[model samples]
Target: MPLAALIVITILAHSAFNGSRVTISLYALSLGASPLTVGFFISLYSALPMFLGVAAGRMIDRVGMRRPLLVSTTVLVCAVALPGLVPTLYPLYVAAACIGTSFMVFHIAVQHMVGETSTDENRRNNFGWLALGFATSNFIGPVLSGFSIDLLGHRETFLILASLAATSLFLVYRWRNQLRHTVHDKPPAAHGGAIELLRIAELRRVFICTGLLASAWDLFVFAMPIYGTSIGLSASTIGLILGSFAVATFIVRLALPWLTRHIREWTMITLTFGVALLAYTIFPFVSSVMLLAAIAFLLGLGLGATQPSVMSLMYTTAPEGRAGEAMGVRSTVLNVSHTFLPLLFGGAGSALGMGPVFWTMAGLLAVGGKIADRRRREVSAQGSG
Candidate 1:
């Protein structure tokens, strides 16, 4: 299959997985769950991934993406359907964790497959397309999820999402041959473990930046429903707010070739933090949906441009034949924040106020932007010297 076809499949499959986050959030809240409890549910999505990320990556390196991708997609199909089967809070807990873990495996494999197949000239561009797939799915997921829940109720929405995954499963099975990588015959990179990969200064810097951005991204997804509910926004309205953010990401990623040509990756990362910080700083002060969505759009423009650069940087910087491992390690770094931030922000939001939660994230973004800017300066100095 062509890269474009795979990207199309990715958008189709991921729309369900990504959009489920909001549906799950709204469903949990409709069940009388508190903010802190909702945080716990969101946290469950990252719990297993935090622990198993590296092993999944290494498994991909040792075997191949085809098997893992197939197995993981199968699991995701089951995971997405679990809630509709049971239709209870407990089932959602199981579903959230399973969905997160399974998608982690599937995502890492797809990324590794994409990176390994592309040459240096188009590697970044290809990842941009991949990232664009994610942005499109992100938009489709939330909007479709929001409307689906409003029109059909949550259980039916889950079923709809599951059908999408089942469709993806069929496609993956049909194209199974193309999924195998050339790297499988080669020996794995020599290093002690993930620790050795992290020890490299470049990877470490990207990891730190990745973590901060992940925290920002997770908080928005996990917190948006609660935040919108607190302000009495309808389910559809809240989804639109989230959808606006995704649209901004789509618009930015759509312009990546031009953006990458004009701006450096680390430089772009720094600007995203600044954009996110400004968004968070304004988030708490708004009550109207239009105002909120506008702010979300601004933040999306900032963070939307990040993934391709980050993935390209890691793939290029990591030790030979270890791109999968590097991607997995990135997941670990991301899930660490994904694992903890919902509870941290949820509790703070409950105890103090939404203002405090936004402020705290703004503070983190400030520090992250500084770190990214320093790296940008260092890169410039080295180039000019």
Candidate 2:
């Protein structure tokens, strides 16, 4: 299938998954779950994905995307629907874990498919298009989730998301013949494993920077609703704040073609850290919904711009036939952020307040930017030499 088809599929699956994050968080809160418990809930989304990410990538490398894509999408449909049918906080925990793991597999497979399908000349733009699809879904997911919850209640909203996922499952099933298995046919070298992939210094830095930006991204997704609630914002308003962030992602991605021409990849990433760090630094001080959305928009621009650049860099940097595995390693790194930050920052936010959580994240961003800058200097020096 073409990249456009993959993007369409991605937008559907991702929208469902993204919407579920807000729905689950708010639903748990409605049921009297505390910030710590909410954090645990959000953390569960990353738990299985964290451990399984690398292996799933390697598996996709061997099996191709057709079966895995259908299977994962089906799993997504079931997971999203479970909460709607059960309508309980405990069932949500099960749904969260499955969504993360199954999507992790689907995500890696889709990315590999895109890279293999594209050439050097158009790779960034193709990925840019993919990111645009994600940005679109980000908007659709949360805005729809928030409104759906307010209009129909959380359970029905989940059922609505499940319907969106089911549509994705149907499309993949229909298009099974069109999907290519993979590009890299040679077996991954025996010496090559996750650890070996990480040992490459430049690719390793890409993983590090990607992880930090991902943490910032996931942090907002995980925390925005909780913070909005603490300060008396309605669910719809909280969703709007998150929605504004998605809008920013869409805008930056729209400009990616022009940006890539003038800005180098590492430069874009390091600058993103600075941008995101600023957003987080200001988040705790602001209480207005508009202001929160503006900050969210700003953070979105920063972190949003990073995904295409990071994916482009990873694909270009990987040793042949190993791009899927490389992506898997990157996924592992990202899931670590997904899994650890919620629990860590969730506990921190619960005990010390959201201000500490925001500021602490700012500290991590500062470190991430410093590392990226150092790596950029190394790359520049190598080019000159």
Candidate 3:
């Protein structure tokens, strides 16, 4: 298949998989799991990816994207399907883990392919388009999931997601040959372990900022449904709130080329953090659904730009032949944050209620915003000098 077709099908499958993220939390709650337990449940989604990311990256470098893509889609089918079949709390945990692991593998391979295909000239532009695909899915998934739950109920929704995953499987198999690169590029000279990639100061900074931004995204996904429920919002209403975030993300991604030309990338990262801090700080104070929707949209504008920025920086900063490894390392950091933030905040929320949880994230984002700002200034001064 052409890259365009691959992107389209992948977006469809990804949207399907993402839809489950919100519904699973609500389903788990219905099964009598506590907020803390739900935290652990959400953590399961990242735990496997947290550890396997680097290895998966290395594997893609050695072999190719085809096998990993096929395997991941297959696993995705099982992950979403099993929940519909079992319809229990334990299976939801298993499903979350499966979805996380499979998607991580699939995502790493797809990103590696994008990096491999791009030359230095259009790399950032390519990543911008890629981020658009992701933003579109993020918007489609949660809103669809929300409405499905409200209309069809939870179990039925899972089955629909499974079918979506299956479509991805079909696309991958059909395009398996095209997915492999025919020509190989020279590997980076250092050619050390994955850890060696971190030695590059710029890559290190990218990882740090990526982790912070990615974690904030995770927090909203994991916490918002719970918070919305507490505030008496229906599943569809909660989905609309989250969907609003996706819409803003889509808009930002569309404007990214212009934004990149004007604002510095590092400055954009810093701005996102500050914006997120403000939004999270106000989250607890807002009672109206429209107010919450507005906040979510603002958060989306802040968070959506981070992915393309971080991925482009990582690809450029990575040593030759190590783009996949760098992608993996970034994945590991994000998953680690994803895995821990929920567990920590879930426990905190259980004890202190959701207000403290959002406040804590706001505090963390404030610190990250400062660090990003400092880095941006130092880069600007160095360039001017």
Candidate 4:
């Protein structure tokens, strides 16, 4: 049931995310909005998710996953469907916000579910599989959406996404009874307030590390395509580069179970961050499309490795029976980074050009790695005691 839910959700969510920029940006362009307005609309999508993520997490704990999942998926289907009907910038922005809200709800609920279902013995593997599922969707969604849009146009593409989301909703409904049973059968444990959750030392370190790394991840992913275009890459070439990145990410995640057994979680986290830093530093220097694709592949491997490891660590460190809240906090911090980092990088890129922005991203990764190293040492020391 978990695997089924993960598969459907990944497909629908990725389709929405990958198709949204194309649909919304084109919609805004058609409405006579400037480049700046398009940027604002994109920023709003990320910002809305960050703003609602923690609240969504709390709501998931307060209620159960089924109600929120159903409601959020329903609203998202409507949001996707509405844009095709109205075709205006205001309505498009509203739809984007709704999509963001739905994503936040779905994200929190799913992570909580994954964390709750797996034992410590298999937690990392479970997360690795989840990451692989998401990466696969990320790989497939944009390419499919682009092709569909070319054949059917943007409005039609959105309607297709709406249909996919509805299919996901139906899957969730099928598993509804099982989901409630899982939630009810779990032993009672502390349901900490947000502050109390934050007070767990290991969990706090995980949050900080996850947030900082995610900020760098978002900055690179958001900025890279625009940067590539500025250097004369075709739209299709840019898509291929990003798509290759996703492919590499999926590949690395498939190997994570093996990798995690051989390397300490902290060591893997540090190594992935270092690789990411190197990729960002070298990103602006590459001009050839082939070379850029190579760098993107390396970047994807690093970025992909970091997330599941962090999630696994957080799940293990979380107080017993509070995995839901811990996973919720992890998702919240990640969503927060997703919200702001792009806007920050976009502004920086606008002011100083792509080269400088890439350099800035490298610096951020370096800083994040240093912090993670310190936190890992602290965790190790605490465990030893």
Residue lDDT tens for model 1, 191-284: 6889988899999989999999988988887788989999899998998998888889899999997787777778889889999999999899
* RMSD, one per candidate, in order: 3.0, 3.1, 3.4, 3.0
Model 4, 257-342: lDDT tens per residue? 78877776787888877988899898888998999899989988988887667877877776655566666667667767766777
lDDT of 1: 0.86
Q: After superposition, how far is residue 97 of candidate 1 from its true place, in Å?
A: 2.7
Q: How high is each candidate's TM-score? A: 0.88, 0.87, 0.84, 0.89
> What ranges in model 4 sit over 4 Å off?
2-5, 180-192, 229-232, 320-322, 375-385
lDDT of all predictions: 0.86, 0.87, 0.84, 0.76
Error of 1 at 65 (Å): 1.2
Candidate 1 vs candidate 2, lDDT winner:
2
Q: In candidate 2, list every pair of residues with a backbone clash.
A: none
How far in Å is the alpha carbon of 276 misplaced in model 1?
Answer: 2.1
Number of clashing residue pairs, candidate 2 = 0
Instruction: Indicate the worst ten consecutive residues by lDDT in candidate 3.
Output: 180-189
Evaluate residue 179 in candidate 4 and report its C-alpha lDDT on the 0 to 100 scale: 77
Pick the winner on lDDT between candidates 3 and 4: 3
Candidate 3 residues 1-385, lDDT tens each?
Answer: 4667777867877987788787788888988999888867777888999999998888777667778889998999999888889988888878999899999999998888877787676666677778888878877787788899999999998888888888889888887777766322456566778668788888888888888788889899779998999999999999899888878999999888677667777888899998999999999999799999999999999898777667777888887667787899988998888777776877898899999899988998988888889999998999999
